[model samples]
Target: MFPLSTSINLTLPIEDPILKFLLILVIILAAPLILNKLKIPYLLGLIIAGAVIGPHGLNLVLRDSSIILSGTAGLLYIMFLSGLDMDMSDFKHNSWRSLVFGLYTFCVPLGLGILAGHYLLGFPLYSSILLAGLFASQTLIAYPIVSKLGIARDKSVTISVGGTVITDTLALLLLTIIVGMATGNVDDHFWWRLTLSVVLCIVVIAVLFPLLAHWFFKHVSDNISQYIFVLALVFLGAYLAQLAGLEPIIGAFLSGLALNRLIPRTSPLMNRIEFVGHAIFIPFFLIGVGMLIDYRAFFRDWESIEVAAVMILLITAAKYIAAFLTQKTFRLSKDQRTVIFGLSSAHVAATLAAVMVGYNVILGYTPEGEPIRLLNESVLNGTILMILATCTISTFATQRGAHNIAMGNAQESDDDRSRRPEEHILIPVANERSAEELVAMSIMLKKPRDPNGLYALNAIDNRVEDPNVEKRARKILDAAASAAAGSDIYLQTLLRYDVNISNAIVSVARERNITDIVMGMHHMTPAVPGIAGIPVPAGPAIGRMAADVLGHSNITTFLYNAEQPLSTVKRHLIVVPEKAEKEAGFQMWMNRIHQLARNSGAKIIVFAPASTMPYLRTFGRRRPANIDFVVFEQWDDLPSLEHDLRQDDCLWFVMSRRERVSYHPAMSRIPLYLEQYFAGYSYVLLYPVQAGPGDSRYL
Candidate 1:
């Protein structure tokens, strides 16, 4: 039996690495659950739990090198996720606003900090300036709260992230300069080295990382390999930043931006990233932050009390002033202003680093044999209290703001949605390769809120005596389910016993009330003998199986042929029929195309007649601004489009069934033209839903 007394060692805190890791994992799992009942935020709970178990509390664990390493990663992960989850379109549109906010957030805190440090604390010139720098720097500690509240894609959040980029960069630069001056490293050579190194690092991360990531993602297919590749890039970028005289968090943020377009939010890889961060890294980081707090020091003396009070006041007031000024300039709502204040108020990451540097820089010796550093032990203790206070304040402010914004959005969305159709999409899986591709396409096309809508159908041949038949079908369904789950989309798999695959699909669609069917152009036509006995397709490009499905299918259908990764496509070359707007599913197809364009961050180039331009532009105005229209009525001459096709473009051909409103005699020849001219290019053949009067709107 293990002796409880033997485990207690006054000289060491959990000496065994395994035991330390086990304790941390248990805390990560249990702290949130235990604290949740008290109506406390899980993030705060993690922090408080850390303080209780730390060396200063019950002394259960020590702040070791392993803890520091993980905490650093968590800090960087916070910045990385902020960038990765940002809506690029919104960020691009509000770049100027972000710049303005960054300046306000940095200048206000910095100015106030210098004054407070000099006047209130009676610090010297360099110490005052360094304290000011700490005030200007902030960590996005409350970012997870907003993300949890589902407002991560809000315009306000985008502005906050952009502003964080600018302020953190500036704060780090300021810290570097102050440290160089104090350490006697400030010279002409230092200036030149810093400038050149910073420029080179930016070029490597901003220009080269994206290219490498694109190449890697395009070539590598395994999900695990792709995730590992992303992590490697993040850490490498962080190390490069440290070498370039910048914080590693900046490198991690840049790395996230470099790979943002490659990883869509609705992807499985993104899901994995978020899961690992929230489950392990972030909690470890929060706990480490709590461990930094020595609560006893807060009441040690009058100087400690004064320093804590001044530091906390300056940070909270300066950050709020900056946020207020920005809000007035932008004419934003109170909740948005509050979010900015809360997000920018916490001073944990850079403040800790700067304080440690100040505490270590020895200036003189006192009578008590205590070394007189640039920042004394009282200041160090004050910083710890400030961190705890500001973190708690930011959490409360952020949660209040986020809750209000979410409720406001819910109300607004309800008002705007006049008629919502109960949309359900059905995707039939036959093979692993096509299943993944089709599931990705379906995720982009389906409605985000309809949880019970997406379905994957698998057909098993009853006549086949082979036992592997059911096994193969189950494998296909599993692959499809995995693909959808990555994007947080649920795919209900249905297995049917039938020799006729198309018939099974139709029956499932009818039973499930599926509104759309996304299929692949995998079936090929049977070959016929040509003049020299060489084979040629006997009928149209699509095989009999596809033709039968299209003939019998009653809902909207999409037939996709992918020659390259959809996420890498640069432009969507949309070819709309002349009378497509007259069809019942015109708006639905337009919405689907827009969804795909937004997900890929690709521009839409529509090639249609003059009559369809007005309807197209009207719809385009409601989405992201990246659509270009070309007035071309000769779409029936499909082979002529080969000149316009590029390697990075996707062709979207909008077609109609026979006797439908948009159908023309020329539509019958499009499949043959596509096979002959656009054989190696990605393309989508969309057959819109023939919706009746009762089912005009889609959910």
Candidate 2:
């Protein structure tokens, strides 16, 4: 070591702080726009810049400040922005597939990581568990990426987003417990403390946040100050978590989620936060990470290259298997299933962050010291390699595979072809709106890809028993078959004595294992006592009786208006409200839209309101512009609130505040609004609460 300087240079001038800050600001301002124009992730550019200017490189502007403050703030912002996107209403209703995928995401790589760390890599038990934890945490970045790729409106997108949230949350929780143990802080009372912490977090979120947020929003009308309110909450929650000796990221996440239920999905504050984080904090964090990358380490350990390759395959396979097993009843086409697996396989920042925290904090190993922390260097390089390779391969394969399977062009492999069973498509014909909606979905599914070997079936349900019921059913079926170009069509017209339409529909679905159910919805009411003595149900609505029977299954329900002439839907929008019922009808709407778009080859748009305000700082700053449907709670004349969305040809769906489900009293008034927009060539759909035992009771 060099001896301390004997002569002190008392007159040495210190670097100007403002000038240093300005230099970074100027570089960041130009980095993303210029680099993104070249088709690269802006984060990549920032990372390179930080690495060059950081101490290991030029050491241009030496400062005593730690990167931790900046990085932690950025990480918190990212997590909080993620929380703003915690719209699980769609997933809860249509999430069996995602749940299956989520579990696979958590377990597969975790087990593999543990094995790799302990047996192959010779790591300690705690360290091995930490490695497993790293693999378990996947980023929820697919939404933004897919949105940029122009597929944010796809059903696959919803499934992926929902699945990531579930899997990541579970992984984080597990990691937290392991960290506590690894840190030797888990004594006899550890369980109780952990339990209490979790309970308190949940209770604060479930009971306190909503009430507080509502009070704040109601009383505080200033737009700028509203953001301050959100920050106050974030700071308070983060501080509280620190006081409890837990990760502040958890508190930030919970605070964001608590507000998710209370704030509007498209609040200006959420948008502003996203922008700030994306523009400043996130880039800084990524750059800092890049600075930490040691290229020389790659040359030092050739074995690491092989480990990365093997780890990638194992982790990918594990996630794929876990998701595949849980999706037994999802009825996903082979291609969609492949896409789910492929997309779910990508894990990057989250994994690295977890491992870094574990190695440095839990294992007591520093990155720059001798015996250089392999946990940081090896895992980072390995993860980046895996992410790049798998993301590319999966994206290409999934896109093409989904296309082939959807189009029915994917024939059985030679081995399976010998034992191939006949495949069929089930189409339920409708003469009313509800039936039309369901049929429209079939059209949507048809639009995406496969067109051959397709079949349609018409179900004629006349309540009265008739000797010629079979003949009448065949007549309707034949007409539908003719319309479908006579493609191996099958018709089932059953004459039943039961007035309960739900029983009849369910019976047919179960017996046939129908690929999809298409139906129409119209107002059903008592007709004036004209010449007919029997009252009829208007629209295709089988009514709550039928909906209740079919609601529990994995079947997808598509509703349309049969009264309107059947035509391809070119553009469709899915509305998602912030506080929608657990079984919100958004999934059904999206499924129908996807089907329609597939058939018509039309572009679909998905939009959701930002959950933050414009002026206030919170988390993520970039608003998703790709999804066509906008998720909003209520629409008003406020120019600052959703005022930019006044374009014509837009469809709006209002969630009824009065009714519990589609059968509620307020549902009756939907037609009034529908008629107003119908004439303008803008279809306004009213997606009332679905028939279920969910949050509808509160609404």
Candidate 3:
């Protein structure tokens, strides 16, 4: 039994733990959805909701230790996700750009902040530099938005993400120096200790964490345990970072980087990790940040308001200037510049941490002999206001910029003009092991503006209608749905008990008017046999189901055999046959390949016939400016070129249905050649949509 409170006053603070927890839970659940209906970013909604219910607003809840802990966890979670979601290949390629932006973003704000602190606030040099460091450090609060828009792999976004890590690290280092100076610990000994600790922390995280995680994942079979272990590893990294005199968020982020390759971006484990953060930890953190605002302070202290305005203006101007300069140096588009600015503008995590540390340091004594705090309440309040303003700007700017980029891509591609605006893709899930990967690939290849999302189908053998079999099929579809959800893509699940899997797939696809079918390659190859009276080679032939689907349907089909995790891929070697450019599905496959290159951060080299080079180059022009495209006029030299392929390269075969243009006899030997020569590489086989009945073919 629970006792009811006597009154529910708007200004009455609720102190009961259970009541406070419930109230917050309710607010977390309702606020986002309500604000979403009105077309608002859920993040902004959470912050605003937090302020409304905080102690200074209606006084529905008071700040407590629990809030502090949750907020801390949320902050770490945000940083961890940022690292985990980053494309390592892109990060490596753009590391230099990242460094440049890091220096620009860091130095500009630091300089401006120092001037403001010294001239406007009348602060000493040390205090002013510390304030500048705070201005320089920013959180990627809007990065998730770029990720949601599926353009996270863009060079601009990748460079911005890399810059965040660099700036935050440098800023935290400055904080350590300031804190040391304030506490009379600024000496050669202090520098030695800091350097040693940081080195040790990096070594342990970069070397030991990955080794342990690999061993644990290999032995630990339980899914729940795996997720728990990842969380534990994150905390362990944070703890180690703290021990090494670095921020815990730094540890969390490094831990993510350590384990990045181990966890596939499309795996169930990755889905679970993102789900927990976005659904719980991150929202809680945003709310806690909101609770920190004391609205009355602004009215009582004009100095605080003035400080906040100055901080906002200076920080915003510095970040924009940095982004603008980077844009000119890199020859980036206006939207890309906005994206960089949006991603690097918000002041949170490191900013707040530095402020709290600054608040506790003692600089001198006042006339009354009271200890003078290094940072006053007015500075703290101003910092909070800056966070709110920057967050709002970041959210809106990122949304608009990402959207514009997506639109630009769609319009620039001439291939898109010939295709339907709506895309209906059918993903047949037969193997649970590869279903998520196939679905994720489908999502990546899909046009951002496509109205029709995806259809996940699991057609079981109708004769053996065991309840368990149906359950298993449903489970597979569920996994596909979860994978789609992680990417913010809509997925419709379909389960049918049918005797003929191929017929069932064709039926569903036709009924749904699906334009494409994506499926995993079957392990077992069919016996050598002719298909529709056409003689087909027997050696390592495509699976019977895939052959049947290709034979029966005119819809485009993509058969993927992922030998390695998609994360490790660095290049795409697409073999385009003679007359491939004349195929009806040529442009569509080109678009998909381009998308794959963008998503994987891989360069593309198209091996096409001399006649097909012009079309291939045109297709290349449609891709993102950062994507590297090379066209080689060598369609007949695939066998000789096997030695040129690196282990990380993915070989793609642009194939076609029988009796179709570009359907060469060499296509029949692909399976055999691939098994013998390219067994260790990741590969995809694409069958473009068939020509209309009235269309002529050279074959």
Q: Which candidate is the best by lDDT?
A: 1
Model 1 lDDT tens row, 628-691: 8898788658788888888778898888766556666666667778777888788888888764
Candidate 2, which segments miss by more than 4 Å at Cα?
1-16, 52-67, 86-88, 95-98, 141-143, 146-158, 179-188, 239-247, 302-313, 316-353, 360-699
- What is the C-alpha lDDT profile of model 3 across 32-123, one tens digit per residue? 67987898887788888888888778888776788888888888887788778767766776889999999999999999999999999888
RMSD of each: 4.4, 20.3, 5.3
Model 3 CA RMSD to the hidden true structure, in angstroms: 5.3
Best by TM-score: 1
Name the regions of candidate 1 deviating beyond 4 angstroms.
1-12, 363-372, 412-418, 449-451, 460-467, 526-540, 625-634, 664-666, 691-699
- Compose the digit string of candidate 2's lDDT tens values, residues 1-699: 988867643321225555566767877888867876876555456656765676545665332354556666676666565565554344344567567666767777788889988898777777677777766666533323342233433455457655665676666666677777766777879878877876786677556875787667655645468777877787677666655545566677678767764443323344466566767776666556545544444465766676567667777777677557644556665656665665566565566556656646635435665543425456656665565555444545455544454344224334433663322235544332233234333443442223342334444446646777667555655555433332212333333333455556656666666544555443434432211111223432224542443443335444444332223222445443444433455344444444443333333454444541221111112222212443443433112223333323334343433233322332333444344334333344434325444555433
- Per-residue lDDT, model 2, residue 120, is 83
Query: Could you tell me the lDDT of residue 604 within candidate 3?
Result: 70
